[model samples]
Target: MAAPTFTDAVVKAMKTLYPPELADSAWDNTGLLLDQALLPEGTESKQSEGAVLLTNDLTAAVVDEALEKQVNIIVSYHPVIFRALKSLSNQDPMQKHLLRLIAARVAVYCPHTAVDAARGGLNDWLCDIILSETKEAERKVVQPISRPLPESLQGLGYGRTMKLQGPMPLTTILKNLSRGLGDQQHIVLKDADAELIVTGEMDHHSALRYTQLGQTVVTVFHSNSERQYLTQVLKPELEQMLSQSSRAEGRVLVSQADRDPFETIDISSLGS
Candidate 1:
């Protein structure tokens, strides 16, 4: 498939898989934020043959990777264009990334909170990670879709909560979380009404408040909580679904340049 046709297929697949309507439009910017057709035209040599790059964030490194590989489109999990841009200049690092992609004709799409609210989406994946130790668990939405509710997505919503059939030790849960997110550090167990909360991050004060009320919030930093889903879940799905939808071979590649900016340092050893 040609690059344009391939990008169209990706946009379609993204919409079919994680509908933009499911996103929290109140704050999020979802869907195809950067369209090549709308942006300034540039030389787009067919390099990777309809390859789609997946990343948790659209950082400068991710943009460089996309351009180097000449990916047809980028399915960034978090939207790059979150706020209004008064100007597209080299003054801002983000605007520079956009400018480079525009020059290379690499399009960008973000699924954001849409993936969180969709059935079998990011939040659901998080639920699976939270319940990795449980043999079976009942899960439900913390907030259900209220507006423009489609019949197919009747029960799908933003956050998810799990109720286990049997009580599992919090230590056991943390162990599974380590295995799931590929990070063994920051596994702290306080308490929770739901017994556990596996989230990206929480405000310091809000987390304190929750803990005061006996709710444990497990934060694996922001992007760390979301990065694995691209490689483990979305990559294979995109390859299969995009191929079928386009009736042509389409590839989905997870960006190697993306990662959580935070790291856990052992100060005890550092000072020694």
Candidate 2:
């Protein structure tokens, strides 16, 4: 028996779970970004046979970790290299990371928006989380807000909207949302209407207006590429792919250090 190469694992995984052609957004940069063969000499062997690191975003720190751990492939949920780079110079931090990964012989693969809109991907997982938390009386009605790029890609969309059964108290709704998101105090409740009018900086101090139509309370939740969902939703798929592949020993690991870059603070608490 022979160990499967990185390309082999990626091909099998893509065919089974996320086909880059079928899953990628028109503007997305999915599929293989960097190949091990393209790396500098004495970096690593051409064969990709090591642990796979799964991360939402690929940073220089992550590349360092991959080099230290001898990780051959990085399955970044978000594409690290987006847009055309005029040059790979030290002036640009992203280019620096690219050069680092290239030198380390690490292969980069990104699923990006393709995974978000996949049949049983991020958006569906997020929708399930919110719907699961709602009480029976809440009678959640969930629908995808973003239309699919093509008509054939039905049920594939970015965000979804859930209409509550009845008008929920603003506080209660906030609490439910907080619990669902795993953060209570840091949740941002903004009035979308006011956002259009007010040009200045608006924090938690800004008044929140809950849009309501008759007995139903409507709220929209937008996910900013949070990696937490990837750990829960994509892990099983990756594991299954690995098990089915020749390289059953190849492990699919979610990066422990990955987190949302932005930190939220409750401005209301500052006043008290």
Candidate 3:
């Protein structure tokens, strides 16, 4: 059988997995951004046949990789073209890639916050992973901080607030979180009240904050998007989508080139 060519039908099928209407924020840009261009005169749609490439961010490197691998579609978890752009030009890196994608005729789709707030989505996945590290005796109650108002998405929400079985010191909690979340992650711990009142350079530099609330210690952990969770949880669904679309073994390729651009630098290493 011939390889399945990407079509509007396939894109529609993919959207059913995480509908754009369920996105947490109204500002989010979800769903299909670009579509496969029509073939030239005398050319066949099958000529554009290729596999799907998944990435958390559609960086220029991912675009080059897609072109090299002959990927017909890109499913980026984050919107590549966000905010109002005055114009598309080489002056901006994102614009350059947009032009490249257009020239190559590759379709781009971003699920964004839809996947984050969807049932069994990113927020839930993150909460599950973190809780998995704790013993059952240690976790008292775990629930979403705020749930979606929609009846269909009752349990789905933006973040989770978990109550420990017993009061734990702020340092101990941070240590446990570090172990679960990984050492490389840049985590900011803040007292919920202080977070609202604090401002200036000191806010950015603080790694951990402690507050006394009688016998209880509470801290909020804020992190940038962790792509690893999305890659792990979404792979199976992506594979199924590909299998159904192509009528073959699904080949969902996660980009190995993806990485967090920010890095923690130890300036102390430099001689003072």
Return the top candidate by lDDT: 1
Off by over 4 Å in 3: 1-10, 44-48, 84-87, 135-157, 162-186, 191-224, 245-247
True lDDT of residue 224, candidate 2: 34
State model 3's lDDT: 0.60
Per-residue accuracy of model 3 over 127-213 as CA lDDT, tens digit each = 665566566766655544535433422332344445454544555445544554554344443454321211101223232332332
TM, every model = 0.84, 0.70, 0.71
Itemize residue pairs with steric clashes in candidate 2: none
Q: What is the lDDT of residue 247 in candidate 3?
A: 40
TM-score of 1: 0.84
Q: What's the CA RMSD for each of the models?
A: 5.3, 6.7, 6.3
Q: In order, what lDDT does every prediction score? A: 0.75, 0.60, 0.60
| 1-272: candidate 2 lDDT, tens digit per residue | 64557556865685567666655455677778777655454654743465788887887777777777777788887777778877888778878877887776777888776676567766666555545555765544434353453342333234434445444345555565455456534443443321111111222322222222122222323333246556667777888877877777877777866656656566888895
lDDT of 1 by residue, 1-272 (tens): 43447889999888988888878787678899898644335754556778889998888889889988889789988788978988999989888988988877788999988887778887777767766655532333232222332233233235676655556677777777888877657764556665565666666666676688786778767777678788788887777787787536777889999977767787898885
Worst 10 residues of 1 by lDDT: 141-150
Q: Which number leads on TM-score?
A: 1
